[model samples]
Target chain A: MPIGIVSEPGREANEFKFITPDDEKLKTGEFVYYNVSLETEDEDSDLFSKTHKIFARVINRDECRGYPDSFLADPEVNPKHVAKKLGVISEDMELYRMTAKIIGYYDTRLNDFTNPRIVPKSGTKVELAPDDDLEKFLTNIEDVAEAFIGDLLHRNAGAVDIKLPVDNFTSTHLSILASTGSGKSYTCSVIAEELMKPDSRAAMLILDPHAEYHTLKEIEKMEEFKGNDGYKPKVSIWGPEDIRIRFAELSFREIISSLHNPSDAQEQRLREAWNRIQSSDDYGQYYSVNDLISECIPEDGSDAISDALTWRLRNAFDRELFDHSRNLSISELLEPGRVSILQLDTISAIDQQLIVNILFRKIYRERINCERNRDTQLDFPVFAILEEGHRFAPANGESRSLPILRTILSEGRKFGFGIGVISQRPSKIDDDILSQCKTQIIMQIQNPNDQDAIRRAVESVGEDLLSELPGLTPGQSVVAGDSVNTPFLCKIRERHTTHGAESLKTSKRWRESWTKNAQVPDKVVDADQDKGAEDREELL
Target chain B: MVSKKIGKVIGSNSHIDYTCEIYRKRDKDNPPTPADHSFGQFVYIEKEIDGKNIHLIGVIYDSQILDPDQGRTGPKLAEPHEQELFHPSYIEEKMTLAGIALLGYCEVDDDEFCSNEHCVPPWTIEIDDIVRTLSDKDFLKFHEVDGEINLGYYQNLMELAGPFGTDLLSKIIDQLKDMKPDEEKTLEVIQKNIEFSKRIKGV
Candidate 1:
């Protein structure tokens, strides 16, 4: 057979080629269909369902002889059977081929058979379809394993990588800011949990004014899961009786203020008597610092400590040398192996400030001294987290402990002393101390003043990022600063232990009480009250 | 670096060299006379420079000035001029000789006070003032030839010139042409020579 090529529809064929015996069986000028099956990865095979179609064409057997082997292989047949087999031919797949000259392609919603459509070859190098199936398959399986381990690990581990920030916090100060319900507390809990890990030798002391951290005791009760080597969180309570001090520690003014009333000359005599008593060997046995004050001093206008000293003097004059007072010294409070929580719940806000200031000053000074004494010069780092910091670290005036705190911020890195001042009202905290923090975890903050305070404190934060603060949902926070390599907007993991802290639900309580009394009739309550009234009248 | 002692009064050339092993103390106490007080209270002087009218303060103890071969020190005075000197700004107390050459002076009366409450006496010369005094040709020459007119250079030149003639400005231009700009080395020198004032100067 000979196949010829024609330039025009009615032009005579000039170029011709001989067809082999295999091609002779095909009818000349007949319409035939060519079918191609596209193969892909098994997982992605479903993507080709809509695109599988056979192309039909009329073959000029004499002219096809001049054609290539690929052209001769296709049958010169009508697409009549191809339509029935492919199921997409009657649905304008043929019309698409005639107009666009495309063979096989995946159909899209936007494709219109009435107009010429652009289609891709089944096995073409260029792919029009999205290639997400392979990536999706891999992600789906990996997500399952991630979820499984997620449950096994504590919530702190699943939260943002806090270790990097914690390590940075050792050298730099950090701040955590967030809005209400933005998991600020949970983030704090996570930090506390991480710090308490056995391998972490760092000591942490948190002043939880709202009693939100009571749930930590519950988290500690969980059985050690895999990878967690029997680490437990311990909490100790400290009262006023833990501190120890001597009369010499008192200032001259404090000693004078502790004396009882008499003439000016008598007051001098009282001071002399107090000095003589202090110098005796049995001073500790005959009188604690408090005993000397009560015997000699009048209780007119005196400081709280002076008043306490006077009261102690009048009460126990014969106490033994080993006698322990109710109030403990600073050393007792910071003793190792004890996570001391000085519960100020029963104390007044003013007293809490005074007490916290005393403790902070003592702790910072001790840590500095300890660092200097070490031969190898290793510091026992302690983190002091103060909740509701605005009350103690107020902005209006310098705190009594401000000097010690400033020293810690400026020089505590080498001494291993870290301080975390937590406050909802950032505007009320001292600006100097707030600016020193190198790490900050910010939650949703709706108050403009607080936001402005935070903005001023963290000079590097942009206004656009601060604008997003108020809308942040619960359990979410923006963690930024030297602690994190890059600022991250992260959803804080839920605390493993349920928080005892919660807003009061007034409506729910009312509804539950109403339901409980629904069984009793209103008339029954009226009759009982009337009966009780009658009985009382008769008795009277 | 030999510290060029400064005087409390303008046009006075008595310098207390800080680099000297022992501090020189005058046995006779000559308290400052009311006449000795001038609007430009602080003046710069070389270590050995002496004057009858000026009261001595301290010297410019800049390390860069000691090593003249390194070129960190600015242009030296072709000839030392005996005249009153004043710092442009109260913020700076000391500067290198090269630094002093770039900034020009603004003349003020001996009793004239500075408008700024914080600045020491002898009000600073503003860019506008400099432009007003120098001719277009001289101004163009300064702009093209003088070292970068940064805060340090301006303050240093003003201090060296004090209230004297405009010779320091020309010297700065010659120095800029003589040396090539080495940004890294220049910055290092500037960092090493920074000094703080002992007391707040009158404005």
Candidate 2:
């Protein structure tokens, strides 16, 4: 039979079998089967004829082909009686065409075919080819969003080694820039999740200025599949320990300097007093700055040391001295074997900056000490993820913590500690810190300042890639750094939980409020009558 | 009998003692006399009993000064004072006569017997000195003739002769004389003799 020709009305055309047939004359790679199907005219018609438009090659003419019985038993014609009537004979009656090219054959098995193109009698054709457009193939934004979140639970083992291909984020610094509602929270969460993986060996400490990351608690409890089991992600939260300065554990100098003084002379006196106290054996043992000041300043004459000491003692003893107790200290939060989050929800931006600086300094000091004391060459490495980093490490040298944080950005790598900064205003973050980041997982960032900042930070990022950044769909990020083979946009694997980034649904809320309060005059009168009748019934 | 032979080989009659004095002027104008001297110097002399030319020097301080007239020839006139007054000069002269006397008995020429210069005793010897000279090999041969010598005894005596002694050469000759011509034994003896000689010469 000629290939691609439909069968005539009453001709005995060739029967195509996927396996060995009654006619042993068919050769390998030769067209053997005539594609035919039954067409129904009206709602009920028993008379059916074969309509052929496709052909199959004799890929395996030596073996019997087994066809699924359901395919042979037409469901529409005889749904209830089909299975009983068809039985094993269904395999011989059904027809199949060779839909692929037979490349080679194996003696033990059958020949292998590739690029299968299935042309059903009336349905859409299905094409099977090697994946050439991997990016496009996986480019479905919704699917990628789901995978980006879903993969957080069913973590592929290969995912742990997939670092964002950048260098020196911790040592150099970085920023996350996007519009307020443009999945900045979700992108930060994804970065946090990637860093928190066991192999990443990173510690995520979110400053959480707006308390937005409190949702992470719920996300961490989302279902994660392991083999056949499920688990909840684990993270630890830390806040200020107590109201006292001793409990807060500020270094003596930090406490003295943070105090407010009336004049330059008072400040100088306070400095000398602080120096004396620090040089003394009993420094930093006091319960509050007031106690420390009271002990340092003596009741005396108008010498600069005596006058300054008295003023400092009086001023620092006030309630304002304990103002720092509201913010948390990093030393209290840094416990080994746990991912610590220092939520700075209660503090202002300036105070948060101070707290983050203290935390970074403490962590850097501890890591350096640990490395120095290690007996062997290999030591455990730690990563510190700084969320909302712009407040602490700001552009234009405004942030009080910038200098120290810049030091960390420039030197943290050699100490085996890394830093990750997440911000929505990349332009506002320190350039020194941002430029040091070797890996960048850029999400949708539309702001020109943020784009320019990112462009300046990553010198190697091309203009083409930079232009593509603002248009990136939710959950899709462009990963570029030493970790990635190339700068390619990746569909972030889905998170395991449904707790996506919470966004303000303004229109829906407004419409729901309007509908809730909408009423007519007649409805109000009926409602008043119903209430009166109910009251009368209750009296009876 | 070996003792007598050894005594003759060592030249018992040719034994001599020579003494020399070194003087220091305490003060140039009024030098202290020997009687008033607080310190004195002497040599503890050793003579090689065998023909080996070994000499040892030892310095002595505060040694007793014996009567110089007892050993000197033309200086003993009368009293002990007279002898004491010229004792330093007298001892110097006696030391020179002793050197002459020893030179006359041996083949060592006068030029080789100076006190101030380093010299070696002559290898060639007069008949009188030959009778007196007991070479270590001759001493070992005397022991062998008296039937007192065993392989171990001869080995010990040869060891004392060290590598510079003629005993090693004599042992090589004796090894070559065995009628059975034990080439292996002869070579072993020669090698051991060479090793001994090298050790003594420190080469």
Candidate 3:
């Protein structure tokens, strides 16, 4: 149904003004269209005529006509009721002048909008674009492997289902940027569920610092993720106690950075010891920390540097994470149809960084080897999600994992390795790494610094969408970049698995505590009261 | 029903305000009296446009008594009662003039008086057009259209009535309230507004 008529051209050529009596439906970001007939010429000068529905989005609204202010002067009286009493018909009382930006017509062959470079004349009827048409025009998800993320936000609930391209986002990196409690982790879980579905069985890993992703174990019980051809996705959660790292896997710099305030001479001595160990004829790719410590003794009898290096090495490597023979195996952590969640809640910040550093470096090299047809434990492509990404790759501070993360982001696509950097503080994340992620799912972020960081990092989200970041409620997101045809707001779908990251209900807990205290009995009888009395009498 | 023939149009100050001369006769029974053509009276003038009869609805706003002998110090040749017998033309010269502000018009078809009312009348009042008082039924019918009390020409009445606009409109609303009780709620709002406007103007 036609809702408005074009009034005139706007300040920009791609924009035009329209008049609508409806005050509610034509809100900002609403899609509308007007039909236009055009003639095209072929190579032989033969003409073909066709009609196209030119689409536009409502950007702004101003009240052009309404009930007089005096009618609303009395606080006790309703303006509409007053207008009705005054014989001023309600239908003609309110009018709005809306400014809409042209999105052009959808070209099916190109799978994108084509600018017609034409504005509708005054008095052209502009109708609301139906949800079915928008569903077809928004994304190319018909026969391709897709992840059902959510629905289009501005439309009615369940009107338009938003399914993102699985292969596009999985190959290219993805980023989930949101403030605290904005359902960023929940959205990640939804994506993980989609990846584990029967249609697309992907090998994915989640570096969960808060242990929130363990709920994804529910996928093993869900039939939706099970394939009819005897395929079932696996969920493996490795807690802090179960994770192990080898001292030989850490680079020289990584080992130095993991120590607490290592002196310059001690670092130099450690590097010399590392070089000596690597150059020895008896050395192997799998050497223990004891071998490096043995090589660190000085030949000149300088005991200070060597003793200090031993103390720091023993202090850093003497943990459950570093083992001589046992470590997280690549073949077990990454399978063709399994989701491995490495929980790091019990580990400290430095240990967390070291773990991510060692794990990502191993997986990245294995992916490269697999792509080259070399013998590798991880022969399939893998996507990894790093929670609290800023901790591993700080912007102002240094981390052992920043360089490896940057390498994986820039060169991982070619090697079938993708990384999703999920961070609440985008400003603290490394700019290079944040920009390298080709697709971004941004929820509400109120901090100006984080919003500015997103603006600098993500290029696909326009200023109009960025302005709406502060007002978006939880579970609402603005998805942009290569996974979608255009940047648009999305109402995230409910997760298949139970969400584990909900906030603590402080008020309900306080109320229950008061009730429990009030209900406690002040006086109580013991089972051996008479026996206790008799024993007291005997003692007296 | 045309209750009484009150006056005839003598002249017009504007397209909306007309002046009429009242017909007063002491010998005739139930003749047009001063009360019949007094202020705030709803009246209409009959006119034919394109062979269709219509009533130009208006209200008496002001009046003037024209006495030809007011300033004369010299005595007449006959007494006041004898002057009508000796000089009947002289007695007929003295008249009562009523100022009528046109509100709107209502179409008339045969005995069915008010078929429809329109705020914009295509024709103006002509000189010597007979003015008659509207029956109570016709007066109530004139203010109602589409099953509601419509005063679409309330602004015209206010503009043409000059200083007594609010008072005249309030009187019409008060009279219609009693005639149409079902629409009293809506009419009271208009009445209160006019009363407030009068106080605001310090009238």
Best by lDDT: 3
lDDT-wise, the better of 2 and 3 is 3
Runs in model 3 lying further than 4 Å from the true structure? A37-49, A75-78, A84-87, A252-268, A278-294, A301-320, A323-326, A398-400, A514-540, B1-8, B13-15, B21-56, B60-99, B105-118, B122-149, B154-203
B1-203: candidate 1 lDDT, tens digit per residue: 11122222212122211221111123125433222222222222211112212111221222122322343456543323321133223212232221112132222224121111111223222211110112223222223323332222334434554543123333333343344343323322322222212112212
Model 2 per-residue lDDT at A438:
67
The 0-to-1 C-alpha lDDT of every candidate, in the order given, reads 0.43, 0.44, 0.85
Provide all candidates' interface root-mean-square deviations: 40.2, 57.3, 3.8
After best superposition, candidate 1 residue B190: deviation in angstroms? 71
The two-chain DockQ for each candidate, comma-separated, is 0.00, 0.00, 0.21
TM-score for chain B of all predictions = 0.19, 0.22, 0.87
Docking class of 1: incorrect
Task: Tell me candidate 3's fraction of native contacts, as a decimal between 0 and 1.
Answer: 0.03
The residue-by-residue lDDT of candidate 3 on A404-450, one tens digit each, is: 89888999999999888899999999999999989899999999999
Candidate 3 has which clashing residue pairs, if any?
Answer: none
